[model samples]
Target: MPALKINVHFGGGAELLFDKIKKREVELPAVDKYLPECEKKGWTIRELLVWIKENLLRERPELFLQGESVRPGILVLINDTDWELYGELDYELQPSDTITFISTLHGG
Candidate 1:
């Protein structure tokens, strides 16, 4: 199985939850390795979230996720475009794609 190379980014305080690294270049393994139950043939944003929580997230998972998706205040962009325009979690990932997460919530 070939790996998919993609860039992941965090900003607007979201990077704090990810060890303040801000950006990462990742290679996703075969679908069966991370998302065995997936019915789809390719990797999707839905599966990527799970992978992140397991492999990349360092702390405060709640601040980044809600149920199987991102918390409401977080903005997700795929290759510089809003993820909503591409089907949100169902968006299939492509090689070299850039996925960015920006937190909209703030403290007083």
Candidate 2:
């Protein structure tokens, strides 16, 4: 059995969800095919967004906006690289892949 370890950075603490995969499974919804798998796994758009928001908020409260969604600012990095640059959420995952999500910071 293959297992995936996820460290969720949310609200004010880190949460972890470990899953055991026996067959084909998609962890993150990306590209086009991920939706079906994600839906099958109970991850809807709202849920996904909330998950990202909560997790990200935990790490950095300032990063999270009360009403605005976590798009264009929040960064999803996989293995120390931005997933959008590679393929966005559509990036595929293997057994030992580690995904990280964070908010971007800038200065003048």
Per lDDT, the best of the predicted structures is 1
User: RMSD (Cα, Å) of candidate 1?
Assistant: 1.0
- Cα distance off (Å), candidate 2, residue 69: 8.7
**What TM-score do all the candidates reach, one by one?**
0.95, 0.39
Which is the leading candidate under TM-score? 1
User: Model 1 residue 17 lDDT?
Assistant: 94
Candidate 1 local Cα displacement, residue 103, angstroms: 0.3
* Model 2 residue 88 distance off true place after TM-score fit, in angstroms: 0.6
Question: For model 1, which pairs clash?
Answer: none
lDDT by residue for model 1 over 7-71, one digit each (tens)? 99999999999889999999999887667776677789999999999999999999999999999
List the RMSD of every prediction in angstroms: 1.0, 9.2
CA lDDT of each prediction against the hidden true structure: 0.93, 0.42
* Alpha-carbon deviation at 6 in model 2, angstroms: 4.0
lDDT for predicted candidate 2 compared with the true structure:
0.42
Off by more than 4 A, model 2: 1-3, 7-70, 105-108
